[model samples]
Target: MSDLSATISPAVRLKGVSKTFGPIQALKPVNLDIAAGTIHALVGQNGAGKSTTLGILAGRISATTGDVEIGGARVDLGDPRRARAAGVVAIYQELTIVPALSAVANVFLGQPLSRGYLLSEGAMQSRFAELAGRLGVSIPTDAEARSLSVADQQTLEILRAIQANARIILFDEPTTALAQPEREALFKVMRDLRAEGHTLIYVSHNLDEVLGISDAITVFRNGSLIETRPTQAWTKAQLVTAMLGEEMGDIYHRRPASRLRDGEPAISVRDIALPGAIGEIGFSVRAGEILGVGGLVGSGRSSLLRALAGLEHRSSGQIEIAGREVAWPRTPRAARALGIALVPEDRKHQGLVLGMTAADNVTLPKLRAIARSGLIDNQLAAEVAADATRAFGFDPKRLFAPVGTLSGGNQQKVLLARWAFDRPKVLLVDEPTRGIDVGAKAEILDALRAFAEEGLAVIMVSSELEEICALADRVIVMSEGRQVDHIDASRAELSVHRILNSAFGVERHHHV
Candidate 1:
């Protein structure tokens, strides 16, 4: 063990911490002690009160009842300024960056360096450069936050927290959008911070990641702390059981071998290329097949899906649905008209309207089916929504509730239901199960398989290799905006190692 781990001290302590929002108790009274100079992991499903605990520590929300102590001193748990003063900061998955501002401006937001009413841009830029170098990340300080990638925005968030000299940094699902290489880089930075005697609270749903990076592991379920122990003392199965409150025999359900190779080609892309994003990509998916796209962040997997869905304008090549070539610059409406539907990766922004009711969202794409004399028939729409709710195993009672009010898994089901309603010939789904729990993941995968089994060609892009291996009949590995290799999932040698090797352009040696 390093010297930093040899001398450990309590950095943040919560006594009887609990929170309630009106009729719902988001968190139960809990106690926790985060150690200094160590990476402590908090694992739970969505809505498991992990966010609430972080909120209280960051002073973003007041605890309903309990006390919070930072660095051995009691601090105000409701004032963000007080929390910052006490060196506590939170980096959430949903970035808090100002899009219109420059990276440097965002780094010093709310705490600008000024000299008598005049801002000191040069000083801030110098400091930011130094910090960026120290963290081993390169980011343009002058560029607008909107122009940066999700990974860059997250890097900026960390830079801001480090600039504040945060003693206890709370990270909530920070790597949800990051690729394997980028995640490794972030972990390096985190280790450096730990070596410098800073405390880290990592909250995530990725069990493998928690196991790899955490010194101590804490599991939360239904707003209650289930267990907190050293990572070495727990197995992945134990963690999953603790998180879900039950043993998940097999989270993934593989289709029958007979069904794997049944249908004819339904969607074909011949040498399709997207400007500056994807190179010539050619593939075909049968009517009853799931083609999984796998790659690191910025590897063009998402772009390829978007291109096929007609969400992106292709510079060249051809897309054929049902053996008919589609025109270039295919718009989304055109794609829908051509019997294609896209369930985008960012479901919150692209897939559904948060403010709209679940019923309204379900019927938004096919309002004509529920219309009378060019006017929407409310009764018909409600029936359609109710049918979709039951079809997707969603609660009919929540049909009238805002789509955002539902859980992450339910929201995802709503998106899938919307596209499945039309019964499109080709379904383009990106990150279908991202940010959802194990149970929800199973439900979503089952639904997709059902769709494919019913002769709907499904193209799925997932960061989870296990998902790809289990659900896909074939996998296409992409890297640096091009298709690198393809793997047959039915092969005995199919593994994450083989997929990753193709993803990173590594040459694999196979015994003949």
Candidate 2:
């Protein structure tokens, strides 16, 4: 398929596209169009049919009813090979690269460079090099995919798409795992692709990125397109209103310094080290305080939290609770016994059992409380689940439903409820509001604030600087696996810019 010439016809068009799964209508009849060689952005909350629409265009899923056109030519929307042949490709958030294979092998996994019965490895590597040079990215063609960083993996996916000569490319949350520099590089590549007449569809939750890189923006709410406007004409507040149907003031409910107590620390760590990953980290969280951990990806923020939770063994460290000296917890059960609970980053894989019910999952950690003589008391378990659901503002009726059937926000709430049931002295949460909608984000923050208000020390790790500034009573900036700067929220100098500077090791000069 050749690129579409300059014409009045749209590069891609969807007419009355709709999707339904069982009794739930994921997407209503929606119509959209993208002009040739332009960067179009699709913005919406989670579960707003963004993924469903992308799925239809990428030929991964069949639309219930609709018509799709590429370069003014109707194509089979249900056939993956047909879509690829029509110059359509998508890069999803969850990477699809084969871990054990080399980057060259993964780029051409199914379509190999073969001469009769023999494969040409040299030809594949040379082709990948050419594509990487064209895209202005440095990708290791000979390295194994599993050894590459998340940002490099994404770059490899983009190189593969370019190698296929795709005229239209779709990116789903491409920068979610990238740092500032990597994001800029990706944006430059996207602009270069547009300059070369490739239609690009960008989807992301970061409004600032949409304004910076998109030419046109489309907002979706409740499975329907709210509006489409030029990026220059749209504002962040307007986009938030369109996606959420209302004004959402301050998503992170930061508590005042007065609310944070100066009493003895609930949890204290001295000289925490995780071998070569992180070195000599020290911090303390008092009751009724939210201590924020800030850093770029791979800067040891997540590793620090894991080490504190006893999920990762520390080479050397002393952990104390309520002024009592205790040995390093060797297991998660031991950590919990010492009044510590960890909410992991990947909630779906690490937090919840998908096949189990919400009530069962919520009360899992506290089974002993609701059991008698090693027998689970069903009524008592249900009551505990009910109390937890109510405390977190989750629906009680949904407790009986399968955990997998719930939305991302509800699933996150289920995890929080489980940890809250234990009444731990300290809570370690990694990315509490990631991949959740704006409204759900507000609710989760409020729940954490409530927990802190009830005298529970909370340690949170997040990549979003805005989240760290909004929710933390104090922020610890980590760089190269070490804490470099500490900013107290009570002081006016604690801003997102300062946090970013600290993370990047940039020295800021203050006017005397």
Candidate 3:
């Protein structure tokens, strides 16, 4: 362990940390020492105790047996306020910004400046403008937080934490919601924060960011710290091996061209138009083929998926399945009836029921199929959930456990299982492996490949060029709500620069 205790005086420490919920031992006795003014990257597989550790640090929950020390002083952070008072700020993946409120209001939240008792809008706006400029985020103070793009919202949140003058910041998959350029800006902010002597505990699934940003890395496996190593001491392969306990070359198992059966188009879209932005957008997917939807954050990638899944009301468009023509589906159920399932990008909000059990979530989408005599067939639901758990390698003993209790990767698997269990002819999967561990990532990709091998069509949208390149047989690049170019995955060299170039065009590379 290189005597981490001797290397640097810890800004925060967790000694003999142990936490458990019900029958699940979420975290074991963990010892960690985070130094001052350094970005510490925490890496682990899904359900590997990453979030649990962060939760303890944030004071959202307490450890069963352990001591939390800040600045070499023990702190009883019984609540979030105490944690904040102790200079600990956590920016979780599940954003809590109020949609109806302005960015300034959301940022200042309950701690807004006040004269006597009334809120000071003028003071708040001035402070917000100054902070936004400092953060290099161009969010309008008066604009609703929800109206802003994901990148802007994330920036606002970071700025909020900084404004609080938090010395220790915990970023839980903060960049997962951001696009490339936005992520770059956030990285700059992290560097600046480090320069200002702020301690950072960066939690992310993107290994590239971890390699580029972190000074030291900590690996956790199944609720225990594997080891902590300096970033210079490891390579990508070594890190992957450490995280997965195996050698993983060729993370994506790419197949040859999809089986073209004369005239069968697995999925087809014609002249699809949104409320105001997109116009005459058209695309198609073939059996056993993976299509990549590449675009900027608001370039209508998610909207197009919603339109395909019949969740959005398309003004004028024709959708088809199995070469037979079909009009725009009215509801999600209607789309599912035609063997179309969508795994939304924001899985927590749009996909899974957080409070429901894993088994319940897996069976929620296909209740009609699993029901008999106007009642849900419990036995059938259990069988389906069990089969999905086995296939996805999710722990079936935790089937009755709440989806909220599961890690990001397992929750994602439950969502995938819900949709995949339907045996859809065409699957619309968006960001299948966002904010997850490497091991779970491989397993998810394997499931997708297996589905494709069964002649099921898959269309995936992701901001990660590596993931898109790895999974998709064909790539469709979108910008400004337009399909600019469709590249053959076989020809493209699967480089970050190439995919970024294709996504934003040659002119935009300078900005990127």
Candidate 4:
């Protein structure tokens, strides 16, 4: 018997599930059975077909050939509505929460309560509030979801799933942007849900979280199931090896700081303030330096990056590039012209034009560079994209594929490649490695280091403290939209703990 077959009965089963996109066999005769009322974790490196499997299960996409059974009954999951009706719900990494809508409204977005044909807003509000309270969250039901933090948004998404009476909930890297406390709360909620007999298929790159929360762990590699073992039977090292099909000694692998003789600032900011929330903020970056911005969700990390990218309306601030003070550019074009580029955190919505091909997406910002006399040079554009793809180790065969067709890490790589060729003087990257696997994270950081080595001022914003500690030459901590502290890489031990302590307002701060 297979290792997975010995553990639990199948609550949801997939038999000979194979999904193909053109030449790419995303899933190859995959067999999966998620046991009922248990937290089952699906883990793998990028492009390992984890999301594709979830998409199929969620009915976002159909399998080429397979049978999906829920409780031993054959299911034709033709659409998401069908999946939901069949007690399946998914909280995707790229959130589906409507920004303009209220929390209650989003919770009951499609399946609103109705009394005699009228929407029961009051009932929805009361139920939402109750759910929120139970989840240890206090987000106002009437407040716009856009105004809520990422953690709140994620909670709302999960609540929606619960409200829909889903027996099997699939979480696609749900806590990628959540703060520590919020993540702890989520883990608690998951534990509570498990006690209440709900099956959860937790997908995440954070191995520790997966191992801690899951009963059974399944590893996928290159569209195939490698090993599906009980949580108790797996070691972190063994699991890491199975996921990557290779041993990884240290995922972080922080290199020694290179020699520096710093006299000039590559980028500088002074008296930066924005309307509503962002208060006085100031910082600077030297050439070949990585500056990390650390803060809890909604603490203005994204806002600061946006302000630097010229996307946000900066109320009062002076930005200087290589000692020359300049006005903040209102348009992205202007920012690009001044040699500044941004990799926005929300990749699906902000980073890539999903409908376009990978080549088209990569060459988007540099269209003019590859164009002549108001006419786009297709050959030149393809060449540029091809070169970038090769350099980034992105599959060239997938070049003609749509940007949406790629995995999270590949999509992120495409985003980086686009900006790399732009040759921006200063690179403002937010959440550069969010939701991607360990190997991909290492590669992305390496690429960033290379970029910095070429003398580009790189400013990165990440909630992951370890990533900051690994890649940053200097780290800045923010709390409530204000810069609280800055530390050099040599003092990472001191800086990381101090930053976290500041983030939590802990008095007993320990550096390291």
User: How would the candidate models be sorted by TM-score, starting from the highest?
Assistant: 3, 4, 2, 1
lDDT of 2 by residue, 1-512 (tens): 11123354788888888998776687888888888888999888766777788888988878999899998888886866777899998988788898999999888877888878999988898898887887788877889999998888888877778778789999988887777888899899899999989999988878899999998888888788788887898999999999999987977555666365679989888888888889768888899998999878889999888887778855568988999989888678888889999999988888899999999999988789999899999998999999988877787877888897676778999999997787899999999987676767788888888888889999999877788787788888888888888777887767888888887878533211
How well is each residue in 410-466 modelled by candidate 4, as lDDT tens digits? 999999999777788899999988888887887788888888888888899987787
* Stronger candidate by TM-score (1 vs 3): 3
10 residues in a row with least lDDT, candidate 1 = 1-10
State the weakest 10-residue window (summed lDDT) of model 2: 1-10
* Residue 65 lDDT (model 2): 91
| TM-score against truth, every candidate | 0.87, 0.89, 0.91, 0.90
User: How many residue pairs clash in model 2?
Assistant: 0
Residue 447's lDDT within candidate 4 is 89
Full-model lDDT, candidate 4: 0.84
Candidate 3 wrong stretches, greater than 4 Å: 1-8, 115-140, 260-263, 489-501, 507-512
TM-score for predicted model 3 compared with the true structure: 0.91
RMSD of each: 4.1, 3.9, 3.5, 3.1
Give candidate 4's error at residue 429 in angstroms: 1.0
- Candidates ranked, most accurate by lDDT first: 2, 4, 1, 3
Q: Candidate 1, after superposition: displacement of residue 175 in Å?
A: 1.1
Q: TM-score: which is higher, 1 or 4?
A: 4
